[model samples]
Target: MEKKVTLPKHKFHIQAGDTVVVIGGNSKGLRGVVKEVIVEKDRARVEGVAMITKHMKPTASNPQGSLVKTEGSVHISNLMVIDPATGEPTRTGRKVNEKGKLQRFSKKTGNFIPDAYRKQ
Candidate 1:
C-alpha cells in the first residue's frame, strides 16, 4: 500500500480576495488583491503583479501565435497584507469575535480588514 504524504502548511494567513502588496522581487511595491492562493505550494497569485510574457503556439483556439502577458505566482513570504487604516503593507492575524466569526486584522494598525475590498 502506498501512503499519502501531507504537504507542509503555509504561514501566511491571507485568503482569496485579500489585498496585498509585493514586498520583494522586481514587482516590489506593487499592490493588488489576491486572486488565488496556492496554499499547498505556499504561493499566491496577485492581480497585476509579477506579470510575465508567454509565447503561445498556434492552436485551434487561436491559430495566430502571439505573446500573452499574465500574472505570475509569488511566494507567500514576499507578500504582506494591506492595512485598511494606514493604507500600508502590514502583517495579518486571525481572531475570533464574540459572535464566533473568524476575522482577519492588521497587526500594524490593529484595524479589521473587511473580507471585501474597501472603497478607495
Candidate 2:
C-alpha cells in the first residue's frame, strides 16, 4: 500500500519568447529568445543555444538516416530574462497591476514587463 500526493506546478520566472541570457554552463554569456519551457523537467529551449546532435533513423520519406543539429534544453536556473526597459538581464517579480491582473516586473528597473503572448 502507498499514499499518493500531488504537488502544484512550479511557477517559473522565465517564459517562452522572452529574451534571456545564459548565466551558467558551457553556453554562458549566450543570449537568445526562449522557444519553449518544459514545466515537468524545469528546462527551457532557447533559440541558437545549447546545440545538440540528434541521429534520426531512416523513415519512409528518406532511406538514409540523418544527423540533425538542434537546440537542446537548458535548465531554467541558468537563464535570466532581459529587462525590456533597461535592455539588461535582471531578476523578475510578480505583482498585481492597476487592472488587478498579476504580471511580471523587472526588479532592476521597477518597470512592468508585458506578457509575450498578450497584446494590448
Predicted model with the maximum lDDT: 2
RMSD of each: 3.4, 1.8
Which of the numbered candidates is closest to the native, going by highest TM-score?
2
Candidate 2 C-alpha lDDT tens digits along 15-102: 8989999999999999999999999999999999999999999998978989999999999999999998888999999999999999
Model 2: pairs clashing at backbone N, Cα or C within 3 Å: none
* Cα RMSD, model 1: 3.4
Off by over 4 Å in 1: 1-11, 117-120
41-88 per-residue lDDT for model 1 (tens digits): 889999999999999999998999899999999998898888878888
- Flag clash pairs in model 1: none
**lDDT for model 1:** 0.84
Clashes (backbone N, CA, C under 3 Å), per candidate, total 0, 0
